[model samples]
Every structure is written in structure tokens, then in C-alpha cells.
Target: MVTGVEMRQIDRYTIEEIGLTEELLMENAGQAFVNHIISLLDKKKARIAVLIGVGNNGGDGFVISRSLLEKGYHVDVWLVPPVSKVKGTARYHMDIYLKLGYQVNSFETISATGLSQIFMSYTHIIDALLGTGYNGPLRSPYREIIEEVNRSHGNILSVDIPSGLSADGNVDEPILAVKATHTITFQCPKLSSFLFPFREYLGELTIVDIGIPKRAIDQISSERFIWTEEDIIQTLPVRKPSSHKGSHGKGLIIAGSQAMTGAPILTAKACHRLGAGLVTLATPETAHQAIASQLIEATFHLCPSENGEIATLNLSNEVLDNRYDAIAVGPGLGRSTKGDFIDTLLTSFNKPLIIDADGLYYLKNFLPSLQMRKGVTVLTPHVGEFAYLMNEPIEKIEKNRFQFSKQFAEKYGVYLVLKGPYTIVTTPRGKQFINTTGNASLAKGGSGDVLTGMVLALIMQQRDVQSAISNAVFLHGKAADYLTRNGWSPISVIASDLVTIMPHVLEQYQYS
Candidate 1:
């Protein structure tokens, strides 16, 4: 998704380079909106109110009002901020409204009591009062109009975006904005549609073709990337019938503590579930019984322990001799981890090293030398853990998720999966993927462990590291989404539930 600033650049390039006139584009946009809205409503009986502002957004409203009136929809036009202020292309459309015998009212003409009644009279409200350039709480009439639109029983359709939403919609904080039931955006989705708080306002987003050249959009390199299921289908590892256990990767997951043994077991099980040829859990000797009986298909390497925590010093030469394809560490691991052990793992395990959870905590002190490590490292950290790694405040990291994730991944020379609502999977080669799947359901305790295992399995199976990571993250969220759709509440869907639902998600995604 393009930010408001980047979208403006693409629009400028389209209009200037491609020679598409602004008036013509607005006309096309208005026509496209009218067509979509007609499909959503019965034209003959539909009573529509077009709330227009003084800018190009208002121009689109004027064109919409004219088109709807011509299509036999009962259309009322509200030329907000005074109709006299509407000028240029906007005024041109309003002039046609007057010439064609349609009425247009303004804030100056309509009384507050009458305004409420007029708004309530319409079955649908079209918000054209603001555009992508708008920021924060709207001033005066715009805010008042939006609040009334919200109060009304009308199904609101916003033009371009819900007016008053900050162009930087991806910010964590919530803002007062117009709540659009459906938004028919031109060209591409705006950044607000991708961000939090304000993202909730843009309900049922649809991108309408507005004649902008695709080549123009391809120029945006603001570290913004989107991954789809088709991307997963094309990139996921192909398992041949002739492939043996030796062909698929053997992943070693060193995790779990006495109290947190579930995390390691979850990771190990998820790895095996996702087609890992063999998954070995290297945990403290005491926690072996927990996973050994539950997940009997996997092998276990019991290490010396004290009070249920693994003695990193007791790691044997036999583990190094195993020559696993991928190794993941850190989930459910207590603070007993030593730097020498991490260094040994870094130096010994030359394949993909996925560090998550407590692994990030253990690796914090070794941050300076992370890039100098010998393997393909992947660090998966939630915002808090990520903030600690950067030695910055959590607020700062949360506010700049994409930038911070990208900088950290590039600086540390590791693929960073900054997990959150829209997970940021940043590759060392400067590519940032904004994952669009999953929901609040995946925000449980053992979710990260499940993700780590899924990533480890994909890395072992697929040689293309970035693609494997991206597909794993996507499928992880899709699993949560599957449970949410099939009778489970987001609150009830546990991390292990995601693991339970993975096969179903994968089968459905592959078939559907």
C-alpha cells in the first residue's frame, strides 16, 4: 500500500507524464464509484446524500451526485463549506447540477436541526468531505458532519478514504475519523488502510481501477511490500512422493524451561506438522517427559539441567555431529543461557539460525557481533524485544515498526520477523514484507514459538530463505483466521489452536 505522500507522487506522474487530465480522472473516478454504489443499492428507490467538501474530493462528490441523479437514485447534494467556495473542476460539476435542475445545499444554507433531519432522511451517505491529505482530528464542520454520519442509520460509503484519517494510517494510536462502511479507493490502498486505530475506519476496502499506469506505482520503494496467498502457492516447497525423510530437512529446536516447556513443544510440533523431515527438541532433561510422550514422533536430546532449565554448558558434541539442516533457539528458554553457548551455536550451526523469544534476550548482549556470526540468522521479536535489541524505547519501535525492523535486519545481517498485527518480515537484502493476514487471536503466549517452528521447517524445506519466511508468516496468520471463521472466538483461539488448524488452512489454501 502506498502512503499518502507516495500516492501523490504516483498521481502526479500519471497526470504529468501520461497526459491524463485531472478533470478526466476525477470524472472516471466518480463514474467508477457510481457503478459500484449502484451494485450495492437498488437504483430506483435508493435515497443518497453526497457530502462534498471544497476540494477535488468535493469534485468527485459533485460528479457522483449528477451520475446518481441521472441513474434515477433519489440524490441530495450537500456542497459543504459553502457552495460558492467550490471552484475549477469542482465548480464545473456543481454548475451542471444546477443546470440539470438538481438542488445543492451548503453549511451556510442548512440549519443544524435541518441538517440532522436531512442526514437522517437519506438511506446512504457518501463522504467526500476529506481526502488522503487530511490529518488528525478534523476541524469544525468536517468533524461535526462525520459524527452525524456515524449517528445516522445510513450505510456510509467514503470516496478515496474516510475523511480526516491521517495519511499515516499505519500508526499505532487511534484517531477520530470518518467510519466508512465501504471505501472504493482509486489506483491503490492508502497507508491508513494498512495502519492501526484509523485502519478500522476503512471497512471493506476495494481498489477501483482509475487509469493510473502500473509503471508509476512500481516506482514506490518506501520499504513497503505486500504478500498474497498466490505468492505462497508459487513459493512454498514442493514435496515429491519420491522424497525421503533425508530429503526434507531435519530441524533442531533448542527451547523450553521447566515452567515453559509448552513453548518448545509447540515449536517442535509445528515444525513437524509443516513437513519438517525430522524435528529434534534439545531441552532440559526434566522437560523431556512433557514433549516425549505428547509428541512421540520427534527425537529428543536431553541435556543436563538444574531446576528445569537447560545447562547450556552441558551441550554435547553429539548435537553438533548431527548436522541438522536448520536450528531454532530461544522460545521458552529461561535466562540461564550463556553467551559462550550462543557463540558456540552461532559458530557451529552454519545453516539458518532462527532466534526468537528468550533467544532474543540472550542474544541482546551479543548484538554488536551478530552480523559477524557464521550462519544465515533470523531474529523474530515482538515490539518489546525488538526495542530492547535496538536499545531504544518500546514506543519508538512501535511507532516506526517498518523502519526499525528494516534497519535492524540490515544492520545485523539477519532476516528480522518483527511480529505484530501486520507482521513486518524484513530480509537482509533490504526487502520488507508487510503481512496482511492473522488477527488479535494470534496474540497469545505460545504464538511466537509456533511461528519460529513454522519458519524453521520452511527454511529446511525451501532453499529460498525470504520466500520461505514470508509463506510461513502468512500461513501462520491464515491458521488463526481459519479458527476465527469456524466457530472459534478470537479470544478462544490459542497458539496451539493455530498449530491444530494449520493442516486445514494449508489444505484449504492449496485447494481454494
Candidate 2:
């Protein structure tokens, strides 16, 4: 989960301090890639074309070409640059590869059509033309070669990163990048592989350890991380045999309007499904009859209504006064002209509070109050909502999401879960986590509501509050991932389906 810059630092530290030579690391990287892709290689018919640049990535291609040649696989080393341009450690590897009696052909001599035909003849195209250092628009032979590689029918394997793709997660011209079928990145994943637009270029990403020591990686400071299954497994709260319904935690979900009763229903369903002990939904009295029979397991506290939306929060009410472990507001709760109750909830609720959907719309006006809250306030905002919250445009926030998310979380003293293709959970202290689970399947109405409920449940259950927040964000996406993998189409996966699929995913992890 290291960025391109952080990875370079680790590589430099490994070479200088850890005593691992550049040549050794390059060889290890090549071998690790070969080991991972060996099963895909067909010695009987495979014609491998290794597209080499003049960088460390090209050094990796030289090792890969030699390794494939020794393994009895037919490999052609195609040099994008002249022999004189290859220098330093990459040139050293090139000399070894040439000394082994394998001649390298320069692509500069080949026509565009000929290059495409040659690439089509190969079964696999090894893309080592560019690495993480590349950004902006492509130029000359590298751009032309990458374009041909993408047009080719061969399965492309990019070394470290797809050629022309930026490793720093900044996608300026993603169209110029090589579309790889499989990218065997060294050590850990590059930040760009997880981002949109650039992510489409990376087919199946595999992180191969290239002998960079854990100590070397640890010495490099990084705030960004990707949550894996192991992280979710370790963070999940356990239900003891002696525990009862009340032992887990109590959660209050104040959501829904007459027109959008399904929002709170979906939220409560997800909350209860995630093992919340006693779940309560407080909505306007007008909407109570609609959702009352829909959720029998949960209790309802009717609130004052104005135009079918909850108009006010009575502080003396038993439901609000209850020592609930967690309280979640705003899922289908309509826009509020008067956010006095929102201000009251912010000041009074001295526990973990999750605000989502219309709640965010209301909370945006009271941003200053969020800083004064005694309880941990979690705001889940999609790009549009976040734009409104920041009083900025969506385009501005999308360009630098990490910076904006961190800044907002730090400024407001609250956890910020910026939801999208890959949800980003940032703490008040600036620690950020990228949830690796989930996909485009989560792009639907009511999905945010379901996530809000899950966050409420996990926040109350897990002892480590931050881990609980991250777990909720990860699992919410995992449920969508599970549904899509198990016969449900991304288009057909409604928000309620996520609530239904979540139990199986949670139980699978819990029992396993």
C-alpha cells in the first residue's frame, strides 16, 4: 500500500542501508514475477515478447528474458531504445543477457504495423517499458510501443506497474498507459493501481516480494494503507458464549421520512444483521406505521413530524436519553431547514455518532459544532456531499481526495469516510485507510444508508474504535463484492441485497 515515492524510499534504503544490491533486487523481482506467472506459460506454443525500456524496469525485463530462455521458453527481448541508451544497473543486466548468447532486437527499426503483428504473434507481452516514475503524456517510441501492446491480442504482463501509468496515484493521461492482463508489482501495490481510470489499465495485480526487508519498509513513513481480509479477521469483534442480546451493544438509528421509509429499514436491517444487540429506529410518527411491521425485531420511537420529516429532537424522550452505545442519524431523512436538533444531537450524544445522507446536508451548516463534540463523530460523504460540506466543487475534491479527506477529518475532529469505488476511511489524527474490498456494484441508491447502519453496529461492538470504523467500511464493500461474485450482477445488486448478503460474509469470517 505504499505510494510510488514511498516505495522509492524503501528501495533506496534497502540498497544503501540493508546491503541488498540493485542487481540482486532486480533479479529477485524478475524471478518472483516468473514464479507467479509460470502456470500461465505454455512452453509448447508460447512466444514471449519482452518490451524493454532503459530503466530499472528494463533491468527487470532483461532478467525475465534470461529466466524465460533458461526455462526452455521462446523469448524475444525487444529493446525500445538503442543499446547505447541502456546504462547503469539495467545495462549491466543487459550485458549478462547478451553474454548468454541471446541477441536483442531494437523496436526503433520496426514499423508500427510490423510491431503490432509481432506483438500479436506472441502469446504474452511483458511490459517493462515504463515504471512508477512516469507521469503526464506519453512520448515517441514508448507511447507508440505501449499503444501497439494494448492493441495486441497477447496477454500483457507489466513489471512493477503498467508502462506509462503513474505510481503516485495521479492519473493525468491514463489513455496513454499499457493495459496489462496481469501486473506483477514488486514488494507492495502501487497507489495508482487502486485508483480509478488508472486501475482499469491494471488487469489482475499481484504484489511480489522482491527481498525488500520488513525493517526497510518499516523505516519508511506512510499514512496510506489497504485493508486485506486478515485485517478484517483480526479486527472483528467476538460474541462470547455467555453474552446475551444486551451484551453486544444498543444502537439508535434516527432516519426515514414518509416517502423514504425504506432507507431506515435498509439501515436497521444492516445494523441488526451485523449483530447489533438492540436496534431502534426513530422517525416521524407518520412514517412509523409503514416501517413498524416491516421490522418486528426492532423497536420504534416516534418523533414530532412536520411535512412528513422528523422536525425536532425532544431531549427528554426515553429513546434519546437511553445510554445507547451508538447513534446513527440521516438515511433518507429529508433536508432540514431547522438543524437545531442536529446541533442538540452533536452536543449531547457523548458516544460514537455516525451521520450520513441528509444528516450530512444538515451537519454541513454546523461544521464548527462538530469540532466541539465530546463524542467521536463519523461523517460519511460521497464526493457530491463532501463538495457541499466543504463549500467547494466536486471536481476540486475528486482531484485530491486524500488531501481533502485528511484535512476535513483533522479540522472537524471527526472520522471521515469518503465513499466511492474504493472507500477511504480517515481518522481525526490523519491516519488513512483504503478499503480494498467492494467494487462498482456498490454504486446504487440506498447503499450509503446500509453502510451507515453497519458503521453504527461495528462502532458499538469492537473495542478498538478506529479498527471498528475501518472494519465497517471494509465489510460494507465486501458484502457488495460477495454478491457480485456469487451470481448477482452489479446492475441488479440493490442496496437491500447488500444487507441480505452481509450476514453470510460476516458469518464466514466469524466461523472461519
Candidate 3:
């Protein structure tokens, strides 16, 4: 989970509101840094070489030197520029170190060759050369030093962020970023830590609490979110002991055509396995036998269509009156034939709707009308489908997925699930949930059908749209996680295999 920080605002508070007194914050930050280092290393064997710059980050290195010295560990401080150039809290800490009889190496005293030789002796390197305040490309002594640090075999622990990468935007150039084994960041994790390119530079991240007041955090409002297990667990629906098949609620799956019966079968089977008391698969009459044979537990509702194609469907008033907790449409339902079928279903169905695949095609054509539905609607779309629905290119959607999802949800007043590596769920109320589960194993065919089924089942079980989406996404990713651990390829695990694994995954999360 990442907690993003606004660097400019934080710097402003530290400099202005905090009264420029480095003694308090620097002391806390340095002590926290020492605590982490102590936890990683043994006192008898720990030997650390600290790299210091002219800024506050360098001051942190100076303070860390004092802390390690007091603990009886061999510590060496290398100040990059001349000690006279160091100012502010950094110079203050350097003077204190010198007064306390600790040796501080100056850039002028040591030649490049001498510095290289000194760097070879340390087991671990502490990177305080540049902090989050650095912008643009590197220059001069710092650039040269970073190159040497990268070449060194010692493990580097970057302070806050890895030095050369931008804290906010895209960094273009072959800048040398610290290859830290662990980064001890203060307060919240930076946005760049989660974004790509820069994310590669940030190894394993550990956000350390530096006692920033909660009131200060509250003042900084951000729309981004990272979902955890605890965040979704409480939202799952609790089943009653007396719950019967009908009590769990019914889900209507209107999917598949003549040659595409497998899509609805996969969806209906998953819905049944996910604890939907009753699942009814509504497809063309010609495909009824195939769906029924595969989904033995689910009831079949045969709708009239043209020549085994889903060109049109006659859903009468009586069928609409029958209570269904949720309805899922589209999944291998052919685009050419099922376009009208989709339009009719959207206009007539007043239940919770799960729209995916071919249904998205029809919805895209008549989005304004579909958006006016009174019932709660969930649109599940991969990048291509999402782009088509929004009348934009795929690249635009991928670049600004979070913003696009949020805007789409707000525009339609419905829940939008932008499916991909990081599946984003956005609600009409402006809340966003970024899913962290699932892997490359889930990037196979029919996975979306299985997800639609699971989400529909959860919604039918009386869970809120948000809860249903979160639980469905988590469970889907968890299933992939299981396959990954068991050494099963995603291509080998069919949609039915996902249904069989659902019980075990749910049991792992079940409380006594």
C-alpha cells in the first residue's frame, strides 16, 4: 500500500511552519534511521560508510554517524563538498561531529582514487547523498559519486527515495539511481514509488513513522487509494444459518449465443459456486442445451432469437416481474446479432446490472440511454472495451486510467471496474479502490467471464456494489495467486477450475 506525499507542501511546513529548527525533526528522522540499521545488522560485524551531501539529507548522514559511533560500531562519514560549503542544519551537525572528536572526510582531502579505495571496504552503504528535494538530471560531483556508488558491490539503503529518480514526474536520461535493498521512507510513500519506471528503481519499500501529527496529514487531501485485506473483509456479506437456495438471492446471466454458449456456462457455474442461491442463465433457445448441460445446478431461461443468433430477445413483463437480485449481460454474445438484445435488456431490466464484453459494445452505442437506468449498474471493461465505450483511444485510457475510471463512474452515476494489471474500481461517490491482488497468470481468456459471475453472485447475495466489486476482484486475484504457488500456468486453469478453488480461498478468509 502506498501513501503519496506532496513534496513541496512537506518542505514548506518543515521550513516555515516548523520554524527551521532542524534539531527536532532531524533528530527523530536520524534516530529512526539508526533503529532500522540496528535491526538489520549485528553490533559485532556492522561496518557502515555514510555518503553525505550539502543538504539536509547529508545532515541526516552526519547524525547517523554520531548514532552509530555511540553504539561502538565502526562508522566513516564522507562529506562530498568541502565542509565550508555545508550550511544550515547540515553544517550544524557536521560541527557537532567534529567537536565530539569524530573524523569527517572532506572532498578536497581525498582524491577520486582514494574515495574509490575507501568505498571498497564497507559492507553496507547509507545513501544520504540526495533526498526527495532533488529535481531534473544530476550534475558534477554528485553525478560522479552516484556512478561510483552504483559500481560498488556493497548493498545500499537509500534514505526516503532513491536519489537520481524524480519524486513526481517522468525522468528521462540514464541517471544512476541507488539500487537499495530497502528504502526507509518517512511518513507516506511517494506516488513515484507506485508508478512505473521510478518503481523499478525503488526496491523493497518500508514507510517509517516519523511522528508527523495526524492533523497535518488530514490537511493534505488525495483521491488515490491502496486496498488491503482488512479494507474489504468487513464489507463481505454474512450468511444466515437458515439460508436456503432462494434466501441467498437469484442471479440472471444473459450471456452467450449459439457458438458462444461456453461463455454463459462459465459465468453461471461461477455464480453458483460463489454462493448465489439460484442462478438462471438466459440465452437464445438454441444455446440452452449446451448451457444447461455444463451448468447442471443452474436453471435455464430460453429467449427467442433469430436463427440461433442473439439478434433480438423478447423479454415479456411476466419474466421481468420475477425477482432477481442481480443481472449480468454480455460474454461471448456476438456483437452483430446481440446488439439489439443488449439494448432491450438494458431498457427493461431494473435489477443490479453487470455489463461486460459484448454488452459493453451495445452500451457504448447507446450510452446516454443506458446511463439513465434507475437501478445500480456495474460496468466491467478491459482497456480496449473501456476505450471504445468512452470514444477514446486505448493509449489515452491506459495513461490516465485512474482519472478516466473516476470520470466515467461520475458521468454514468454507476460503478466502473477498469480491468488490467491493477484493476481500478471507482464509485459515483468519488471513492477509488486500487486492487493489489492477481498476477500475470490471470491474463488468459474467459477470466473476465468468471469475474463477472463472481461479482454478480456477490451482488445477488445482497452485498453493496462496492463490496461486491472489491470481494470479486480480491478472490479472483487470490485464485491466480494460488495457481502461481502451486506451479499451475494460467492457460491450464480453465474457468471451471476457478469455481472449484473458490471454496478453499473463501475458507482462508472466513472467521470463526
Name the best candidate (by TM-score): 2
Those runs of model 3 whose alpha carbons end farther than 4 Å from true positions after fitting are: 1-23, 33-39, 42-47, 54-69, 72-75, 78-122, 141-152, 169-176, 305-309, 345-348, 391-396, 486-496
Model 1: CA > 4 A from native: 92-101, 170-174, 313-322
Clashing pairs in 3: none
Kindly report the root-mean-square deviation of model 3 from the true structure over all alpha carbons. Answer: 3.8
lDDT per residue for candidate 2 within 36-123, as digits (tens), equals 9899998999999999998899999999999999999999989988999999899999999999999899887899889888988989
Alpha-carbon TM-score of each model against the true structure: 0.93, 0.97, 0.84
Give residue 89's lDDT in candidate 2 (0 to 100): 90
Q: Write model 1 residue lDDT over 391-490, tens digit each, in one string.
A: 9998777666767787888887899999988888888877888788998998889999999999999998887898889999999999988888888999
Model 2, position 147: C-alpha lDDT score: 80
User: In angstroms, how far off is 71's CA in candidate 1?
Assistant: 2.1
Error of 1 at 338 (Å): 3.3
Question: Candidate 2: lDDT of 226?
Answer: 79
User: Scored by CA lDDT, what does every candidate get?
Assistant: 0.82, 0.87, 0.78
RMSD values for the candidates in order, in angstroms, are 2.4, 1.6, 3.8
**Which is the better candidate, 1 or 3, if ranked by TM-score?**
1
TM-score of 3: 0.84
